[model samples]
Target: MLRLYESSGRKISARIALGWEPSEVFECNLLEEDRCPVSIQGNEINAAFGAYEIKSYYLRK
Candidate 1:
C-alpha cells in the first residue's frame, strides 16, 4: 500500500520504487471503497497528485 498526501494546493509528481514487480496495481478512490486499475512500468509506479488531494495505491504480487 502506498499513500500520498499533499497539504498545499499544488500538483506534484510521485515515483515509487518497488523491489519486485507487481502483477497488478489498483488506485483507490477518495473514499477508499472503490478501486481502479493502474498501469505499471518497470519496477516502479509513477503518479500525479492534484491540489490538496490524497491518493492511495495498492500493489499485488
Candidate 2:
C-alpha cells in the first residue's frame, strides 16, 4: 500500500498507475490523516508480460 498527501494544499483528483499488481486494491478512501485518496486504476504497466502484468493506480489528492 502507498500513502499520498496534498503537500501543495490543493484539492485535486487524478488517476495513478502502477507497474505491478497487489493482493488488495485501493478505493480512494479518506479515513486517515495526512493521507490522500487514491484508487487502483489497473495492473497493465507494460506489454512485455503475457498475462502476469502488475500495475496499480491511485488518486494523488
Candidate 3:
C-alpha cells in the first residue's frame, strides 16, 4: 500500500516509482467500497493531487 498526501495548498503532480512492475494497481479509499483500477506505466505511477488531498494505492504483482 502506498499513500500520498498533498499538504501544500496547491495542486501538484507526482511520479511514484515502485522499482518493480506491478501487474495490477488499485486506488484505495477510506470506505473501501470499490477498488478502482489505476494505470501504471512501466514501474511508475503518475498522478495529480489537489491541495490537502490524500490518496492511497494498492499494488499487486
Candidate 4:
C-alpha cells in the first residue's frame, strides 16, 4: 500500500491500497510509489497530479 505523508512530519495522511497496480513507480504517479490498497477513503480521497499536496484535511486515494 502507498503511504501518503504530509510535507511536514508532524502529521501523517493516508494508506491507499486502491486496487490498482502498475509495472513501475515512475510510469504510474508521483504519489503512487508503492502498491495500492483494496480500501481507500471510499469517495473522500482527493488527488492532484503534478502538485505534491494531498490535502490539508483529508487523506488521498
Q: State in Å the error of residue 7, model 2.
A: 1.0
lDDT of 4 by residue, 1-61 (tens): 2434356534444443445433332222355444343333443343433234443222232
Give the alpha carbon lDDT tens digit for every residue of 2-50 in model 2.
5444444444444445666543443333443344333334542211112
Clashing pairs in 1: none
Candidate 1: segments with Cα more than 4 A from true spot: none
Q: Select the stronger candidate by TM-score from 2 and 4.
A: 2
Model 3 residue pairs with clashes: none
Candidate 3's residue-wise lDDT over 16-36, tens digit each? 998799999899896554789
State the C-alpha lDDT per candidate. 0.86, 0.38, 0.88, 0.37
Q: Write the per-residue lDDT of candidate 1 for residues 1-61, one digit (tens) a residue.
A: 7787888899988888899999999999766768899889978898898998888888898
lDDT of 2 at 27: 37
CA lDDT of 1 in candidate 1?
A: 79
Worst 10 residues of 1 by lDDT: 29-38
Most lDDT-accurate candidate: 3
User: Residue 31 CA error for candidate 3 (Å)?
Assistant: 4.3
By lDDT, is 1 or 3 better?
3
**Model 2's TM-score against the true structure:** 0.39
Q: Candidate 3 at residue 50, lDDT?
A: 95
